[model samples]
Target: MQEETIKKFMYMNRKAPYGTIYALEALEVVLIGAAFDQDVSLAFLDDGVFQLVEGQDTDGIGVKNFSPAFRALGDYDVTKLFVEKESLEERGLSPDDLMELVWEDEDDDWAEKPSIRIVTRDELKSILGDQDVILSF
Candidate 1:
């Protein structure tokens, strides 16, 4: 990545950590982007919402829980976090079910918060269309 280049990184995490590598790998990449000072955003849909829920008990699988790591994202300046509203509703979750990890003040009108920006499925698709770089894990 060059300072003169404008690059945007987007991640679509669609699987659960216990069942696949998506969530874990995404987390690692997000951290790496922060280290490199790149612009990055993430969307959680489908089973990916499981990644944000609190009290993730991965003890049985010997993998450390990752939800808490998200709390540290602000320090890295990777602040764009969107969760599809329909995805939460489909999974029987409201924004309240999640921990604060988004642009809360400006996005407060939305039910999803801390800093959540709610989007319909179509909007989600449209945003993905603009991703200069897209990663699906």
Candidate 2:
């Protein structure tokens, strides 16, 4: 059954892109959320930040690169991609180092941001105000 009542949503991806299915699963969830016509937000945290690392090499794993799917986020209207600034700093990464469309501001104008924004964890948790649902991927 489909739920027409969905309003706002935020997804927290908290694992490494490889060595696990979290990254791929999260991407699928984002796609489905968009298909449902609900507002969606994706936040990358912890080891999950690896999903955005630029110049990924998955050939050794014998799997296609999943980074390209991330770039399609905007195409599906799942444009609110977020990254915990601290997470990146801790991992020594910058938004420029990742793949896909992400926000640089709360209103990064999903249609115009050249690159994704880097937000602090506190800022992320705070902005999540009144979301109908929060899913951790």
Best by lDDT: 1
lDDT of 1 by residue, 1-137 (tens): 46777678888877866677778878988888787666787888899887787667888889777777888776676778878988989999887778777433334563423545678899999888888998886
Worst 10 contiguous positions by lDDT, candidate 2: 102-111
**lDDT, each prediction:** 0.78, 0.77
Each prediction's number of clashing residue pairs: 4, 5
Badly placed stretches (over 4 Å) of model 2 are 1-4, 100-111
TM-score of each: 0.83, 0.83
**Residue pairs with backbone overlap in model 1:** 102-115, 103-115, 104-114, 104-115
How big is the positional error of residue 55 in model 2, measured in Å on the Cα after superposition?
0.6
